[model samples]
Target chain A: MFIEFKDVSFKYPNNDKNVIDHLSFTLEKGSMLAILGHNGSGKSTIAKLIMGLLKATSGSIYICDTLLDEKSIDDLRQKMSIIFQNPDNQFVGVTVKDDIAFGLENHQIPRQEMLEKISKYATLVDMMAFLDANPENLSGGQKQRVAIAGALAMETELIIFDEATSMLDPKGTKEINAMIKKLKNEHNKTIITITHNLEEALFADRVMVINDGKIVLDGSPQEVLKEQTILEASGLKLIDGIAIIKEIEKTSLLSKENKEKICEALWELTFKM
Target chain B: MGINFQNVDFKYAKKASHKQLDNVSLNIDEKDEFIAIVGHTGSGKSTLVQHMNALLFANSGNITIFDTKVVRNKKIKLKPIRKHVGLVFQFPEYQVFETTVLDDIMFGPKNFGKTTDLAKELAIKASQLVGLDEELLTRSPFTLSGGQMRKVAIAGALAIDPDILILDEPTVGLDPKGKIELMELLLAMQNKTHKSIIIISHDMNIVAKYTKRIMVMHSGKLVFDGSKEALFNNEALLKEYNLDLPTAAYLAKELKAMHLIDYDSLPLTKEELTHIILGDSCNE
Candidate 1:
């Protein structure tokens, strides 16, 4: 497993109840996982735990077969990168090129190699044209692209997107979604996306839902999303067409076989559309 | 009366090549108006809404807010216009700076010259309107959950009792249920107060489900402004503006293409689409 959480549990210092309660999961290399949950469901807490920003109250976390402890924390983090929700808060440099280079410089890549890596990753995210442009002047989507470039330039084995597209417009969201797909397929990077958007989750290889800091559903998107009751209970919903199908399921108008056929047809149709 | 804009144009900088709002004209009623303004990022949706409360004066033409008239480069008492139109910015949670939720909610009413006691009263009422718990009002706003913080911020906007309310991408970060609840709350508030509501959203589903009027901006131009049906049905306008169909509308289009379902107008909600799909079965 590329990443594993073994009976992982976390609790805030001031809170009595555990925020993450006996959670366990595994992610294979080069596979994409989408973590869906409502506000304060401890979705972000999972990310922070993985990034070693917060210590677990109990249990253990393993990355690349190495136990995440005080000694291994820095080493494990070097193999991963995180993109936060707010694009404005993430920029570390004045220009796009400088922003991407900041990470490379931290890893102490030689000056010549850093320049080449910056151009390569920037081109991969389609932000090559805006290398010299000021980060403040870029659109939300463009800033996120630069953030992606920065993450990719680090050459990390894993990338975590923590509500990365929540602040963007539809076009920006689409752009970032496409980039995530490309990263998994072409770049062979293990990716974990934390989002409330079910539409974005549809593309993930696996989907895990959280509710009140507990894993409510864990399976492929098809399997997990079909449990609309569970999703709704967790402050989530199936994407539009599937949601409509779920509503149709309650009505006795259609025969069982016909309902199944319509479900398949509508699901495929909605995706293609 | 309400708000009217006639050939309004605005530029962020005097030397800027393009106007943020170019030759935009529109009318909004003070009562019973639910309008959604949508466009791509940096397409002037934000700029257009900011003009409503006199946050940004026009570079040309004029804006009439009730009895007040605002012209280019003309200074007026913005307090009255602001009092009449409450603007809730994007990520309204960031705007909460007071120690307690109640203080934050009361800030708006206080700024508008309400007495301390009256502001507290209005704040409590507004908090209740947003479905906020009374216990949370006394807690630090920072300690509340994201949804609760958002409600607190909205309560701040509502405390002033504005005739018109404007929200910029209010549902951006909320979960599915939160999004629906917030929209329902806004709808209920509008119905109860008979005040106009304006939202700038990137979510087509929310716009299709909530707002009656749709305004599309592209390249700083009001390319299309009409009913949701007209805007969603116009393929060319949608393509030109880089707008997407709401999920129900898109599903309807796909179903029509497959020759499985046919309709005169696109369904904008799941309920509407389900009705069309199930047909007589639904009625039965």
Candidate 2:
């Protein structure tokens, strides 16, 4: 397992409620997993725990089968990177090139290797042209591209995107999704995408629905997204394609097999339906 | 009874070469209007709506809201214009500061010089309009859920009793259900009050299903202004503006390819697409 969490339960110091309650899951290496939940459902807490920004009040978390603790935190953090919802908040350097190189500078990488990594990652995210441009002047999509370049330049084994596309327009979202798919398919990057958007979850290898800090549903998106009742209870709705299938399932004309055909047909459509 | 902008040009700085609103001309009726302004980021959608309430004055040309002239040099009190044009920014929840939901909703009305009793009444009415209950009104706004906090902020806007309501990406961060519920609430409010609504959004689906008129902005220029149906049918224009076709529109195109539906014009709503696909065999 690349990452594992066992019997995790956490509560804020002043609060009686456990924000995350008795959660257990393991993620395989090189697989993409999406975490879906309503606001205040402990999704962000899980991300924080993985980033070692918040210590697990109980239970254990292991990276590469090594237990996560204060002693291993610095080393573990170097193995993972996180991109937040807002790129403006994550950007640290004045220029895109400097921002991408900021992490390597922390690692004290030699100047020659740092320059090569910066060029490689910037080219990967299609931000090479704007390497010298001010990060503030870029569009939301472009800024996200710069952030992705920075994250990728870190060369971490695991990357967590916490609602990274929430602030973007649809075009911007599509651009980011394309990059994520590339990263997963071509580069074998392990990913955890935390979002409320069901459509985003459709691209994942596995999907987990979190409610009240527990995993209520976990499976392939095809299986988990069909559970309309659970999705509704968790304050989520199906994507447009799945939603249309659900509505079609209500009719007498289409059989179970035909409904499945609609799902496949809709999924195969070049454009989003 | 409407807002009119003519040859309006605005720039953040006088020395800035590019104009934010380049000769923008548009008319928005005060009654029975549901409009959506859509474009990519930095396309001047936000700048356009900010002008509706005199929040930003054009550097050149003219803007008339209802009957008052809006100009950069004008010293007239903008409170009256702002009173009739309530502008809700993205994430209106950040504006909620009152201890209780009721007090938060009443703040706008009270600031507008309504008596405490009248403000309370308006607060109750606005909360009810947004589907917020009296019980929640007494609780701390901070304690409410994200959806509820958003409602409280919207209620604050409604408490001002604006004739025209403008919201910037109102459903940006909401979940799917939350997005639909908020949009439906706005539709219900529009139905009950007949108030004009202007929404700046990138969700083509919401724009297609809810708004009657569509305004396309591109690079700080108004490119197209028309009905949603017309906008969806214009593939070339949609591509030029970097806008995606709504799902309903895509479905229509696919159905046409399959020889399932033969309508000359594309459909912009799910129901219309369903009718075409199911061949009117399913009951409405």
Candidate 3:
């Protein structure tokens, strides 16, 4: 496994109940995993645990076959990066170019190599034109792209997005979603997207619904998102695409077996229209 | 008279070059209207709505909400206009501060000089309007769930009894079910009170289903303003504004193109789509 967690549990110092209770999961290399849950369901806690910001009360974590603990903390840090919800809070440099180069500078990459990597990643996010622009002057979507460029430049094995799309408008959200798909298909980057948006979950290779500090459902997006009961229990609903299909199924025309194929056709139709 | 804007232009600061609202003009009726403002972020939707309550004075043109007129270098008492136009900011939880949910909700009415007893009466009525349980009134607002916190903030706005209510991205971070519940509550409020409700939303489906009128903004200008059907049918304008078509309309259009469904017009709701697919009578 590229990353593994076994019976991990955690509790805040002031609270008696554990926010994460005996949670267990594993991720393979270059896989896209989406973590979904209602508010206060310990979704963000799992991301913090995997990033080593919070220690597990019990059980173990392994990264690339190395046990995760204080002894190997620094080594584990080099293997992963996290992008938080608010892009403004995560920005550290004045300009887009400086921000992307800041991460490489900390890793002690040579000056010549750093510039090449910065330009390469910036172009990947389509932000090469704004390299010298002030980060504050950019739009919400542009700022997020710059953040992703910085993360990609680090060349980490895994990246965790913590509700990164929650604050964006629909257009901005769609752009970021496309970027994630490209990072998975083209760059072979392992990703863990933590979000409450079920539509985003539909884009992932695997979806896990966490509730009450435990994963209540886990499967591919096609399977897990189809379970209406589980989705309602987790304070979620079917995305509009699937919901429209289900509505069609309730009518007399479409059979259950043809639902999936027809739904895909409808999506393709929507795009062409 | 209703709200009117004429060639409004606004900038955030004196040194800022980009105009947040440039040559903007629109008119909103005082009652019997549910309007949706759709746009990409920083497209001047917020800037335009803020002018309704005089929170932002126009730098170049004139704005008249009811009888109050606001313009550059003009003296106008904004309190009366604000009393009629209630503006709910995005993430209203940041505005909550009172000890109890009831107190928090009553704060708005009290700020307008209502006596405590009268404010409490208004708060109770607003809570009922939003379907908040009476049992939770005494609890601290901070102890409630995110959805409940949002309801409390909305209730605070309702307690003011404004003639017009405007919300900016009210459902940004909520789950799907929570979003529906909030929208339903807003709809019920509009129906019962006959207040003109304006919402700034990015969700095209919600806009198609809820509002009769749509105002599309791009580059700090009102690019399109008409019925939802007109807005969806204008493919070139939608593309230029970078807006996504509503799910049902887009699906219907595609199905028509594929020759899969024989409907002449696009469906704007799931029921309409289902009817066209099944070739059944419009039972719904």
Candidate 4:
């Protein structure tokens, strides 16, 4: 496993609540995993814990078989970069170009090399036009793209998106999704996305549902979404394709008609009927 | 007769920037109804709603809200329009300026010249409406959790007893339960007070389920204004405007693909969608 958590429990220094409690999971190299849950489900907390933003109260995390401690932080952090839920909170530079350079600066690449990486990623996320644009002046979607470009420019082995698409419109979201997919395929980067929009999870290799600070469900997207009760209680939705199958199971139609209606509905719903 | 905008035009003249909103006209019915104005970010969605209250008066043309004319040429007393139409911004954290929760909720009512006692009374009612506990009322506004703080800010808006309450992305960053609770509270408010509720959100699922109508804004124009069913029925159109059907509607459409559903009308909720898929067996 590239990243593994062994019974990790995290509680804020003085807070009573264990934001993430005794949860353990793993992400293999070059694998895409998605965490699905409703608000306050500790989804973002888990991401923060992995990134070493918050210290765990108990247990430990291992990166590539190395126990996570203060010493390995520099190396572990290099392998990981996180995009927060709010684009505005994470922005640090005045211009889009400068923001992307923040990461290259950390890696200590020379000015020319840094500019090369920044220019490359800016075009990748379709932000070349906004490269000179002010970060605060860009629209929500544009801000998110610039943020993504900054992370990608760092060449982090693992990319964590904490509802990164939530701030974007549909077109912007689809663009980011396509970019994430391409990175996982071409660059072989491990992608972990924490999102409430369940539909986006359809493209994930696997979906894991976290509730009440625990990982209650983890499986292929199809398997997990098939369980209606668990999804409803967690406030997540099944992917569009699978959601229709479950809906058809509830009603008792005539034997021959049953097969027919299911087909008709799928066609109509999928843009054919 | 509640609000009217005739040939309203506004231009933000940056040193080199061009116009934001071209000449546009719209009329809003005051009686109990919900309105959602959606557009890509910077498409003038926020700019237009800011006009509902006296936040930004039109540079040109006639404007009216709650029988009060408001434009560059109209009466400048914005106090009444703001009181009647509360515009809840996207991020409550930016809007919350008070020290304590109680003080925050009292800000709007206090600004409206209500006595301290009346402001407190309104605060309590608004707090209950948003599911905020009385215990948290004394705590610092910044100390509360994200979900709780969001409710407190909304409670502050509700304290003024706005006949038409407008919220922009009330559920952003919230968990599913929090989103559901907020939606239910808004629905409850609309039910009891018959107050007009307008919500601007990117969540198609929420829009499909709760909203009776939608107003799609694009490039500073009102592109589509109609029922949710009509919008979902035209998935291609929604995509053209950079939108998609909700998960439920997406499912309904998929089931239709398999010849499971006959009606083309898009149902908002999963319950309604289940019946549509079951066809005659919907009740069962």
Per-model chain B TM-scores are 0.96, 0.96, 0.95, 0.92
Task: Select the stronger candidate by lDDT from 3 and 4.
Answer: 3
The collision pairs in model 3 are none
- lDDT of candidate 3 over B78-196, digit per residue (tens): 67787899999999987899999999999999999999999999999999999999999999999898889999999999999999999998888787778889999899888899999
Lowest lDDT 10-mer window, candidate 4 chain A?
A264-273
Off by over 4 Å in 1: A255-258, B72-75, B280-284
- In candidate 2, position A206 carries an lDDT of 97
Interface Cα RMSD, each model: 1.9, 2.7, 3.2, 3.7
Candidate 3: lDDT of B254?
A: 68
Q: What TM-score should be assigned to candidate 2? A: 0.94
* True lDDT of residue B23, candidate 1: 98
Which of the predicted structures, 1 or 2, would earn the higher lDDT when compared with the native?
1
Model 2 residue runs over 4 Å out of place are: A253-264, A270-273, B138-140, B260-265, B280-284
Give the residue spans of candidate 4 off by over 4 A: A237-247, A254-273, B14-18, B73-75, B229-240, B281-284
The clash numbers for all candidates, in the given order, read 0, 0, 0, 33
Higher-scoring candidate on lDDT, 2 or 4: 2
> Which numbered prediction scores highest in TM-score against the true structure?
1
- TM-score for chain A of every candidate model? 0.96, 0.94, 0.91, 0.90
Residue-by-residue lDDT tens digits, candidate 1, A1-273: 989999999998887999999999999999999999988888999999999999999999999989999999999999899999999999899899999999888879999999999999999999999999999999889999999999999899999999999888888888999999999888899999999878878889999999988999999988887798899889886688988788778878876766676677788965654
Q: For residues A158-259, what per-residue lDDT tens digits would candidate 4 score against the true structure? A: 999989887676666777788888877888889999998676676789889988889888998767766778987887755444465665655456355665
TM-score of each: 0.97, 0.94, 0.91, 0.91
Model 4 chain B weakest 10-residue run by lDDT: B14-23
